[model samples]
Target: MSGTARTIEFDQPGGPEVLQWRTRPLAAPQAGEVLIEQSAIGVNYIDIQHRSGRYPIASFPSSLGIEASGHVLAVGDGVSDFRVGDRVAYIHLPIGAYTTHRILPAARVVPVPEGVPLDWAGVTLNRALTAQYLVNDSFPVGPAHVVLVHAAAGGVGQLLAQWATHRGARVIGTVGSAEKIALARAAGCHEVLISSDPGWVAACRALTAGEGVHAVFDGIGGAMFEQSLLALRPNGVLASYGTPAGPIPPFDIFRLNQLGSLHITSPSIFTFNKTTEALRARSADVFAQALAGVLRTDTPRLYGFDQAREAHADLAARRTTGSIGLSAR
Candidate 1:
């Protein structure tokens, strides 16, 4: 059955002010799809990019957000994996999660475990999946490796720090302020330093006894891109994941040759979770750790669904920590 639900959307690309709360008639699940009643939504930096036109919108009146956790209200024909009343969570493209109800492709939805909180699922699903690939596939962090993670108190950063430390790697992290130092340290960083310190890059080397880190996981792009390269040792890997500060400008490729023959990679979750099977596997790895009491996910800053604009502003300003999640209206 179709129903009218309140949602957030933007008629044009602009700031948080451009977002408007409107009611839309949600259609019943189509083939290979399911209708969901959201319990929580993720507030991310990419949502800001979409709201501000930093990332091009395919059309006007575009709804933002891609991560949410909720219950399955209905499932389309031929859908056997799930039924009404199953708790589920999802994070993927084709946006429009800034609402209480939505219809999404069944392939994108995954069952949330019994013990995991829905709000935590909403915010950390994508970030945990991201950390999975970043730590396991991107560079395969493990024992004997010393890694440097930028913005180590942020959503994905905390997960990466904890997971890498679990794998026996020594984690050295950089945060923007002293307030986040202890947070990163609690997340399992052997050492945490303020990024603004002029000697921070040298500090990373100092932590590693002048050898530098084996890998530098950088999501704070733009100005930090070059510093990440400098923080890596000879034959080290530099993985650039996201550009919250701003996108990285073009640079000389020969600089890699001079910078200790460093290996650099740019990874996107869409590329990593390209298949349903792959997505499910990563989700299992994340929740399993959560159930085992190894990985942490209880640190989200909660906001009501109507407060998405405020959420965007806070996230963009770096005024929030851990994860940011929006509860359903």
Candidate 2:
């Protein structure tokens, strides 16, 4: 298991151009670890943040990427849950998935079900787990709830919308433009609004008969923070999970009380699935949703390992929809 691996690394955080391909030595898995030959790697907005230094990495010569899927090549001692040749996928914290091979703790790996494609698992696992927590644990969307999902045509947004709707919540989605409306609607949004519209907030309020929605899933941070707050009803929860637009600006805490005692929380997937048992339980739900047609399993747009820059460019420019991934082969 000692060999070379092709990886995308960056010496400094800047832009997409900072990502460079290089050959690095690989070693066998240590105890409680598994060596994997990756087939697909996920591309997420967080990856863009890491590239641009919006989310700083600890070192200069750092690898970026948190999710990938492939087959187990070897397993270390005390790892009997997985064997060589088992299809697996993982999403973990110490970013380094943008490589052809890697060694990860067995606790971090999940078995990809037989009918699910490795590519789909690679690109969708993180997002699916995110959606699971948002709809189930964050605010617990239900039949009586009316929720607003921002950037509904995007990766996690689409999954979130669908999962909320499946839970019987009335989902209203917002997209950057009218061009993305159909995709948002297809993802089970009962209504889609153009986010750029000056009256979009008014429209959302109108849709809820002026009472406002029961929950607001706002990923567009600063630009939409106040608006998301305005879209919620009394005691409604605003889950501020991401900030692809920009970090939320500081505002008076009293605004929550002024806005009908509303509540705001920033939820993280890592926190939701912090333990091995929690991770496996949550991943099982995602896999069951995909297998049962509650979550879509379509193939996503992919980039070759050499095109990592182009992939980041497309994702940051908002030129792609759904999930996008990288091919290791």
How far residue 104's Cα lies from its native spot in candidate 2, in Å, is 0.4
Q: lDDT per prediction?
A: 0.90, 0.93
Deviation (Å) of 128 in candidate 2? 0.8
Candidate 2 vs. true structure, TM-score: 0.98
lDDT of 1 by residue, 224-302 (tens): 9999999999999999999997988888989989988889999999887889998888898899988887788675777
In candidate 2, what are the lDDT values of residues 23-87, reduced to their tens digit?
A: 99989899999999999999988898988999889987999999999999999999999999999
Work out the TM-score per prediction. 0.98, 0.98
Error of 1 at 86 (Å): 0.5
Q: What is the lDDT of residue 115 in candidate 1?
A: 93
Q: For model 2, how big is the CA root-mean-square deviation?
A: 0.8
